[model samples]
Target: MLGGRAVTLTVSSLADVSALLAALPEGEAAAAAAAAAREPRLTKPAGSLGRLEELSAWLATWQGAHPPRFERPVARVFAGNHGVAALGVSAFPPEVTVQMVANFQHGGAAINQLCRTFGIALDVVALDLDHPTADFTQGPALDEAGFLAAFQAGLDSVPDGADLLVLGEMGIGNTTPAAAIACALFGGEAADWTGRGTGVVGGALARKIEVVAAGVARHRGLPPLEILRALGGRELVALAGATVAARLRRVPVLLDGYVVTAAVAPLEAARPGALDHCQVGHVSAEPGHRRLVGALGKAPLLDFGLRLGEGSGAALAAGLVKAAVACHTGMATFDEAGVSDKG
Candidate 1:
């Protein structure tokens, strides 16, 4: 049994995870070059389109075409209750994690609304909540078996025919674990990585910082995967797995804010080029998020002071990606429009 629940998977150790994920097919360089060449010939001032041009080129490289398809985007929100929530880290209770999962299923959450607006399908993977991982401040949050199981759940959650993926998470007190993971990976003080998740402050916030610091102190020198095993919540491990899986599948990933970013930090560490498969949808208002994004070397598409998770930022950014694709494909060249090029 794993996480107080039975979990079935074929793999035994973290090493098997690398075997399960192959390198992302290098996005088509020829196609990207061709798209870049076409952009200059378009009936517009040079560089007038700004980041849309970059987005289109990115899509072209990944899709192996000048005009890439951005349809059938999928958003996966992994839900779990963190054992760290037993501390006063979050303003919300742990049960809210389960309640939010139901809200996601019932189409009542903000993410559901955003996904509907963007016409993206939503999938929520619920981890074993009957037994949340142990408090990482004292012990490993998940045993090796449990961590492997959550990782597999992430890999299994990726749906077929998804042109792109948006990753999100729902777990009360998750920020504590995420911050702990970041601190371990980035070599920072607990205060550098910790943030006020769900708006906890004063004594609650101080306690949260202490808890993350303790977790980081307890497991500072472990391997990347072991740090994840020791300090990560089930949902976080699952999201990291999903990011790697999406890369292997050659699907681009739109990453949601802080917690999600922290979850993937170790994956990026384990596989150096893996994060090239993803783009940040937005930077969360959470302080640790910006540091993590910088660590990944990604510039966010939006920066609206959003701290809400559950794929809200990713869903909003998907529309912009789709628009970028449309503009890249639909815009006419100077030759086609019979307009003379500026010599």
Candidate 2:
């Protein structure tokens, strides 16, 4: 129910999307173009700065400042279990959720490693969707009334002074729900978004699609909240709420993979401004992922064919953001660096 309140406000028209898109600073594109033009004359070989210069311009535009600043970066990973796992949609068992949460807490997960490397703070939250609730005694699960409560807890836990937020997931069998949700939002076949989640094999993949299709069928014509109740996982709901909270707080969100993006759709629909703070980390290897990004009108930063969840892509993309900020803040202007200006 955490995101339930927010989901009720979903946007249902392209006009809504247009208005939100229009609100983003027009100066960002102009700044990026200017940076692209200026990078060639910085006393270095022309275009030697490569993507770094482009990234800086983007950061400047996004932050609405000539030089962007990345003061504090935080990665938030949300974990939950799914009731649909009974249908064999995932290769890994539900136990992995608890295990991975523990690993994250103890500093063994990939997110933890990446955060340490980048000097970004990490926050992990465990939510119970409907099943495997016994393991996550430390966190609240989604029930009729506890949904919003869980989401608020996660929102409040985000560290003070954080400038960027990266959202990741740790739920077994979640891809099934994510695919179903994407298909509903985009009106696509379940198979289109289905992939070998956590190394699920051929037959398992087939069964996963079948099960998700059934869920989608049962929930047809229902509202987004009801669809979520019937087919969505708690982690997804919580992530959606967090996305809204981040937007309201004016903190940029670095999105990881499909599951996280799926969670954000409801928020993006409800408050189009919510997405202005989001940066797609990468184009996930999952076929459905590209479709989702396209639907959201976003271009991801990387394309290494990575399918691993846990905010890995977001963590990796953080380097690009840092470099962009550095270029904006560290690079000297034409007059200050004493570089010749092209009249």
Candidate 3:
């Protein structure tokens, strides 16, 4: 029901989901157990270090080995325009979307710097979800038909054998529509999720809240497809489609923030198991982002109170995943190290 072209598999009951979850590799758990069993002898008392030790063990389990590797990780930033910018809900003008896209292409944005620092491969895709006029220039600037084409293009662009994928956004007024989409999917008032985006102050914040509420009100009884059409951006829709494609290809997706999460909701609705492929990178400063994460039943890895929305949070967290993999792969088990399991 969420992704227009997605095929809904017949899942009759909760048992089906249980079966699916059961079939997933228990490697992470096994790795965790192994890591935990080895920690007491590493010149530390049992459980003295608390969460960091627990996290290391957890990563070992998730990687399904005593040590994990996050080598050759990739971050993909998806860019598009939201039609709601016309509603004047943001401080920056809509042209900033295109300008920022150019900035990203030129390797000048925060994500670029962070990814370069971490040695992560970065990929950018433009989704044609809205028609930007001469007044507004950054694009996968597409009408409905063009959006569909761009969606397919995004699906095709994913590289094979990618260990991780981080989805990010670059639309100027996208938070307005992102909040609207969140409200529609999760049954909340738009104002509850709306927040000041991009340093909007005073009257601009109030206007943003009002615009989101209006969009939610307008799409109240509409179907998901119609709601997306009415309030969604090209980037959101393309990300949703790309999420589905990524799942089919068996790659993990790291959601950057509220906007990227909202864009990928249709994928969750379309393929319920698809959510398993995603990891939320962080809790965003955007008010709606927490609500969205709650709706998806996901806990973010970090919270730096970020509101930048340029894959900054996701790029930042990539280092953690790498460390996780390193600990999982490099640390020896008690049996291998000939240490007693007991503290």
**lDDT top scorer:** 1
- Per-residue CA lDDT of model 3 for 243-302, tens digit only, reads 655554445566799888887775555445557667788999987898888888888889
Q: lDDT values of the candidates?
A: 0.85, 0.69, 0.66
Q: What lDDT is obtained when candidate 2 is compared to the true structure?
A: 0.69
- lDDT, candidate 1, 1-343, per-residue tens: 3112333333567878765443345676788899888889888999998998888888767655666788889999999988889878899999998899999999999999999888898988899977888989889999988998999888888765678899999999898998899899998789998888899988988899999999998999998888988999899999988886676565788999988888888877877777876889999998998998988899999999998899899889998999988888888899999999898
**Candidates 1 and 3: which is better by TM-score?**
1
Q: Candidate 2: RMSD over Cα atoms?
A: 6.5
Which ten-residue region of model 2 has the weakest summed lDDT? 1-10
lDDT of 1 at 162: 79
Q: How many residue pairs clash in each candidate?
A: 0, 5, 13
Judged by lDDT against the true structure, how good is candidate 3?
Answer: 0.66
Q: Rank the candidates by TM-score, best first.
A: 1, 2, 3
TM-score of each: 0.94, 0.81, 0.78
